[model samples]
Target: MEFRYLGNSGLKISEITFGNWLTHGSQVENDVAARCVRAALDAGISTFDTADVYANTAAETVLGEALKGERRQSLEIFTKVFGPTGPKGHNDVGLSRKHILESIDGSLTRLQTDYVDLYQAHRYDFQTPLEETMQAFADVVRQGKALYIGVSEWTAEQLRNGHALAKALGFQLISNQPQYSMLWRVIEAEVVPASEELGVSQIVWSPMAQGVLSGKYLPGRPAPEGSRATDEKGGANTIKRWLADEVLSGVQLLKPIADEAGLTMPQLAIAWVLQNKNVASAIMGASRPEQVAGNVAAAGVVLEPGIMNQIDAAIGSLAERDPAQTKSPASREA
Candidate 1:
């Protein structure tokens, strides 16, 4: 597997990271999740990404159990905070010092590890002071709970402020995890540039646009049974926006491109994201072992510049490129 340094940090992560977001605890049973993890490991994926709020904390427990016998020093395990994971208490969420401090212990316990390679803010906490959040992250690093810090889906302005604070406070904010895909170009206009200049690389999520770019959801037909679009308990809701006929038709246009490149649609999608120099890794989620094997082949596959232009043309106006649209919710609720 190809590995890249996460932003300017010394830590190297696999180009394809196995992530458990909707599949680990909600969509798939623990045994199936373990099989998928085994597949990722067999495929040489050393980076695993999860979040405390995923499946209300069960995802981390399952992941920890799955990697029980693996050498911990060889893996780059990452998890995030900022969402409410337990009882609906006011203080059970956000980036407050209290929440971050308490959350790290719970995460470490559930992860079966003493420290995570990276701890990210799942979303910007508008309710907390920026300095308070950065200082709490610095404390997390100082305490050795996490080796580095990252943020997910934060606006460029917020990232700049956070990076500046992290620098002043003596911690490295090395990565940003955003929802990037062949269809979602929101990060390209501003987030990528800001992160590039600030020494932060993007570990993008949803490089397949919630499976839309896989070309499985054909136009003029119902979603395939058990597909993400039909799995309400998993990604159905989030993927609805990409189910329109125009988008599906555009995706269909790329099938020939994949054929020409000898890549599966998913591989094409994943490789397209990796083409960006600022993207350190693309997180992939799977409920089955073969799915893991299929997607990881995109690692180290470089798409010709001409093929990338063809992708843009095929997606046409379906791509969302507005930098302003890259935003987080205004409030953190339990």
Candidate 2:
């Protein structure tokens, strides 16, 4: 797999990071999940991403077992806190010092690693002071629990403020994990520009729009029996809006573009996101081993300038580009 430096940091990560968001514990069997991890390794992916909130921390355990024998130094393992994990107690969530400190320990234990390559704030914890959170992250770095700090779905303003604080604390906040795809451009107008200025790179999730951009869901048709749109427990809610006729029709327009690029719809989608220099990696989740194999092909792909234009035109008004659309919980109930 091709590698790119994460942000301006000296560390490089596989452009395609294998992530276990929904599949590890909630949706797929443990054996299947392990097989998928093996598939990722076989495909040359050395980067792995997970979060404590995923399946209430069981995902981390599964990931830990999956990577049990690999040389930890050769892999860049990442995990996140700041969500309601384990019984959703009042003290179980947010980026408060208490939660951040305790959560890191739980994460490390579950992942069977002494430290994570990156520890991220799963979302901006509006309920807690930013300083408190940054200071805790600084401690994580200083204590050798995490090598780097990152955040997910943070607004450009939030990133700017958090970065300044992290710098003052003698650490660097180098990455932001955001939902970015052919159909989602919310981060482009503000977040991307600000990140470019601040030396933060995006590790984008759902480059295939939670599988929507794979073009397997057709317009005016019932979702395939086991498609993401049909999996209520996993992705049906997040994917329902894109199932509308207009959106589906728009996605279909890209079939020819993918064909011309000598790539599949999913590869085209992942490649399209990697074309953005600000995006360091596109996180892909797989339920099956072959899915991992198919997605790794997206690594090292270079879309022509003209092909990029075709994607924009094909997605048209269906893409969400409003900077205002980037949001975090106003209160940390989530």
Candidate 3:
């Protein structure tokens, strides 16, 4: 597990970070989640990502329970806010000062830790004043409730403005979590450039396109049962966007390149994302220990120029057909 500086901050994190989205609370039981966390730590993943909204706040509890026997100081935990955790009520969520303050306390309690390594606003909140949100985040840093602050799925302008506010308030905005993958290139248009300019490092999510790049999906066939494509809650949006005809065709086209390099499609896809200097880490969601082990190995495989060219050609071909359809929320460069 290679480690990289998370932006300009002094902290260094594992290149392959373990994140619990659906697999923790919604899909796997606590015992299974604990096993997965142990597997990740064994593989040298020091960073663990979670959110207040995932599984209605159960993910943090599960994670906290799992880490009971491990040395807490050895792990760097990250969690997020700004998503509705309830039944879409007015007071249920957002980046408002009330929500930020209350959410941190709840998260800290559930996580069994006094402070989070990285605390983030999960998304842009159009209703809240940016200053209020920035100040709230700064307060958390000052109060020692969180060590660093970040934002996710925010536009380039939002990242710039937020970082400026944090600096003025005497706080460091260290990272931005966005969906970036070989299949998604929208970030290349502006987000990537903005991060480079502002000295913000990116920790990209869905580096494998949610199993599409894992080579389990194929064109002109029914998706295998029990895969993400078959998940009742997880795969609908992914299937509609990533498992579409054009994307699957692109995956098929890249298979030979992976074979030639003695790599799996997922390994090539993940390495391709890491090749970018701006990407600090790739957050992978794994339901089982073997998946975590496999993903860790991908970080070591170097893609030759010819194999990279084949990937580029496959992406080019996919771009030509309905160029608008390939951008999934996870892959938008921003």
Question: Which residue pairs collide, candidate 1?
Answer: none
Residues 178-203 of candidate 3: C-alpha lDDT, one tens digit per residue: 88887776677777788899888888
lDDT, model 1: 0.94
TM-score of 3: 0.93
Number of clashes in model 1? 0
Model 2 clash tally, residue pairs: 0
Q: Which stretches of candidate 1 lie over 4 Å from their true place?
A: none
lDDT of 2 by residue, 1-334 (tens): 9999998699899999999886799898999999999999999999999999999999999999999999999999999998899889989999999999999999999999999999999999888899999999999999999999999999999999999999899998999999999899999999999999999999999899888899999888889888888887958998886888999999999999999999999999999999999999999999989998888998999999999999889888999989998889898876
* Cα-based lDDT at residue 206, candidate 3: 88
In model 2, the runs with Cα more than 4 Å from the true position are none
lDDT of 1 by residue, 52-143 (tens): 99999999999999999899999999999999978848899999999999999999999999999999999998999999999999999999
Order the numbered candidates by TM-score, best leading.
2, 1, 3
